[model samples]
Target chain A: MEVSGGAPKSKVKVGIPRALHFYRYFPFWKKLLEELGAEIVLSTPTSKKIVEEGVQMGFGELCIPMKVFYGHVLHLIENHPDLDYLFVPRYVAEDKDAYFCPKFLSLPDVIRILPNVPKMLNFEVNVKEFPISQSVIELGKQLGVGQSRALESYKTAKEYFKEYQDFLRKGVPVNHALRLVQRDLPFTVPKKKSKGDIKFLLLGHGYNVCDTYINLDFQKKLRDQGIEVITIENLPESLFKVPVIVNKRLRNYWRHEEEIMQAIRYYLTKGRDEIDGVIFLISFACGPDSLISELIMRDMKVVGIPFLDIIMDEHSGEAGLLTRIESFTEMIRRKKRKLEMDAKKKVKSKIKSEV
Target chain B: MVQVSDKTDGSKAEKEAFLGIDVGSVSCKFVLIDIDGNLLTHVFLRNRGSPIDSVKDGMAKLKEAVQENEELQSYTIKACGTTGSARYLTKAIVGGDLAKTEIIAHAVATQSMYPNVRTILEIGGQDSKIIILRDGIIIDFAMNSVCAAGTGSFLDHQASRLGIAIEEFGDYAVKSNNPLSIAGRCTVFAESDMIHKQNAGHSREDIIAGLCDSLVRNYLNNITKGKDLDEPVVFQGGVSYNQGIVEAFERHLGCKVEVPKYNVLMGALGMAILVRDHYIDNETETLFRGLDVSEQEFKTSTFNCGDCPNNCEIVQVKMPSDENKVIARWGSRCGKWEVF
Candidate 1:
């Protein structure tokens, strides 16, 4: 209300907490905001100090991820005092049938109760009844931007977002993909380097899997060991089509849950040989991920493909996690070795009969 | 046995034996196996809160045992492998050929004896694991998470509280006609229930028997939930020494559960088997430091790394024989101080 949202003089500063769906939608938000002439600020990546402060400030009832978001919010509020507004979007439903967790739908109001908070830029994202542009226009009106101009910026941002997704489908990591897209560099897919003979499909929420401090850089650790670590976002989104994943009898109404199940189920059936094992990371902080992981575990069990479910709460001991992962890879290696030997044996017998 | 450089004397044949050390939270084991898979010496020692001491002491006993044997003269440790909670630490101290997880080691040991083993229930000192195998390969495994109900430490505590030695627990539990229902969801709840049963005029045998039943139920319901427990089921680890718990597993699965002869030393045996099988065709010299490590002094020190806010505790171990140089460093979350 005190200034023009687009002007360079006293430019509006919008703070985005680095948690939750930040990994998924940050690039799109940054593109749209930059086009609309607003500056953006982000909380730093999660650290030990931030996590401890978050746990102290957060109540016992809130889940670990909620506590993490609280820490990021506090970081943004305390670190960036010149912030004009905090962008906490109310994400309800991504599709016609799927909705987000209640925390995402309700956390904006919850943060409002915190003392001495900056003004919040609350936007609704419900793709079921409206397109994302409709939601953007409503937010644009609040920011004192013309609807037509906001619509134009939205279209351009949409293209940028699609390109980013294209990079993801090509197996470029999210961080590198974001950099390539944000810098508006010449488009070229990075060549795929085959590391390990084995592939592991890592399934988890984007926030849990992408947060390095939360998971102790587990994916990279696996990659260093020559195991090609992949996530749902790394593959084509078309794998989650209604015909491929959803049936009337078996469907998950949660958008994130549906993605996780679809990715795992894809590996279990059509892409069974694409991966040697599956590692589902579950944050004990969130109940839904655990429930969905159990369902995925059963499918992996029936197929006899190796599957390991690791749980992380406020803090997890690395020793236990290391042991489980080590043994799991060992099991897969032995199984592969035995299969090759058996195949060789069969071929040799056939050759003997021909001779 | 005739492969030694000078084989004229059978006693001086330099019998090739693999050394396998398993250092868990509650106990440590040292095993020696000849090339034929015959166990020469198996030593199980209580950890007593320090696995370093257990390893040092266990090695001493193994050396004395080997020297005392009349047939295995001119003894030489060909290769060494480590498994269990402190496997990495043990490897650093013992100069092991490889460090493998207890799950893999246990699975290998069981399938070597019973090739068709489908399920393996291992209740050790601080952890309990259930491994599912098919066609002699490990498929699925789960460790007891978030509780110590099925572990040996809790059972030992309960036995001491009831004034009964853990080794004789089976004798008392077998006499119970009606076992009391002890809580098995957690150690805290189980301890309180044990006290209440003592006050409620329940016999000691009944309480002990009830505790074993409760532990098996908790393991199946929590850790191995919905896991298939097929035939040729082998039970190993320290808990297999207790007849009551073994019988409880047999009853719970409604199948015959076989406990191998070296049940307590299966992890060590498995590691020995693994290293031997892996190096069977290779000519590479072993990295084993030999049994002299037991006579040498091991110096360990822990200091908080003040580099960051995390203040990770970095532990470093120095071998006095190696000019008192640091051998291994651990306990840093960032892996900056990792030396092994």
Candidate 2:
């Protein structure tokens, strides 16, 4: 598949392991790599065999997602033996307060230690420390591309990435947004509808929430229960623009944690009436989540909003999770009924007194 | 029974009742409640790895009890709800109108009885949990399903190992004046520590008390590490009946731990209440298949679908009366085979 953009003399085969930030940033990397005249090869989706292999091959203490990442790397190596380079970016920081998890920052180094792994092409994308454009130019230099051609491709990729983010903000799930970007389809936001009887905001990282296999298709389960499911990504940009942490002590240093905390704060303060409950879905053994979830739990308690924290791992059973979600929705529905009854009682009392 | 007698007599009245069943890994519990949330009767049985048999036995006993009681005979089971680990399995078996998690079920039951309760400590056969509440609404909760160090089964194994009756294990611990400190981080370590204490000539009472203390400590450190444990704290589930653990929790938290009369059956009670409320709100006929399900023979089978790279292992439950029809299907990633 050749395009009109300045084509390389020979098409370079680029291997992209389908794990970790791939769920979130695959569009940007894919568009950029294809524009640079490269063929993208992705590892297969995670499965039982992949998880077992990952568990056997990886450190016992490493989180399940990280282990799954290793399995994908192995898959890519086994399947695409002739690939020129494996693009494993060193994602240091995305926002000022939102830093990548320690595992993410050290992912490239971790994969490099694996035996017989192919050569990796990496660029430092620490928005806090350096410019992304500079990283792109450096990456292009390593890929043997001209400066002007690389710069143009980077601009096009950035635009596509921005559109992808916009779609996420408009409530399009990550996987669907990636598909839209890959197919060059026009971006259309799902029309907003009246909120259902019960609404819950699911807070978690994009990978844990979007991966159906990893989370056991939690979204579908919630939808089946006739409850509206909303994610942090569904919130508008304005909700995230204002700083939620007024207390200096509670200010989070991690980039994603800050975003999550901000969205939670927005829901508790401004969106309280619109939301019935908040469910925090975190991967087991996630260091950042272990700390951040505690903070969110404390804050949720103070706000008096119902909250449920579900930890998902390879061993997470589907029945247990469903029961929890079902009960939570039922409890919310009961609370709503009581509130309506109280309101009606007050109205009846007022009418009686007037009469 | 006292709570049931307190309600006004409806001698000639045809009252509606809701049924709740909690089928966990180690036990099965059933509760019957009236519309006003008065517990009519409850039964708890050890599952012994056969939830279907336990549920069927519980149902048969409940049916017999209802038939024997004049007041209960007039009460119609309008709705049914199921909860716990085998919620889906039991829900299918009973044709339940609603299915919920044990967490919600316990929280609802506690909130109904003690509106001001801020904390709930539930320890079942295989799992333990700490649920934080505010204004009768569950605010935060955590369960230790991954570990066995703090669950009821661990205590049962230790009791059996010590040649003491599980029922009398708590009394022995309560008799101890000076409880020794035993390692409680892992079950195997704790078991070894108990043996060492015994070999060192420590009294059985002290060792048992120490075991209880260790389990409580492990629970606080792991499941409820950062949770807010405000009072009034209500402890329930099978472990709540163990006075030794209750004392250990009370001593550690420096607060009173209230154990409800139907502590072990709280999940079933909560589910019944949920179904009662659900029926009232929706005003639709319940999907209950009736107590006759106890006599039916159900079958389950699973196969891996090869249509895609996902290869999801789809589980199908065949209904008893209808042999050819699949009552429910799960474990499919794409929702293609999910008949329910």
Candidate with the greatest DockQ versus the true structure: 1
| Cα lDDT tens digits for candidate 1, A1-355 | 4456666465689999888888889888888887776888888888777788788888987777778888899988889999988988889998788889888899899888877789998688899878888888887876778899899989988898887787788887776665565566755777878768898988888788888778877887687667888888998877778433444687667888888877777777788888899998888767678777777777877887788988887768777888888888988988999999999999999999999
Distance from true position, residue B86, model 2, in Å?
1.4
lDDT of each: 0.83, 0.83
Point out where model 2 deviates above 4 Å: A1-10, A94-99, A127-130, A191-195, A238-252, A268-274, B1-17, B34-40, B66-75, B111-116, B132-135, B225-231, B280-283
Every model's TM-score: 0.94, 0.89
Any runs in candidate 1 off by more than 4 Å, and if so which?
Answer: A1-10, A179-188, A243-250, B1-13, B303-311, B320-324
Q: After TM-score superposition, what is the CA distance of residue A355 in candidate 1 from its true location, in Å?
A: 2.2
lDDT of 2 by residue, B180-246 (tens): 9999999999999999999999999999999999999999998888677999999998899899999
Lowest lDDT 10-residue stretch of candidate 2 chain A: A1-10
Q: What CAPRI-style quality would you assign to candidate 1?
A: medium
lDDT of 2 by residue, A52-92 (tens): 77788899899888898888888888888998999999999
| Number of the predicted model whose TM-score against the real structure is largest | 1
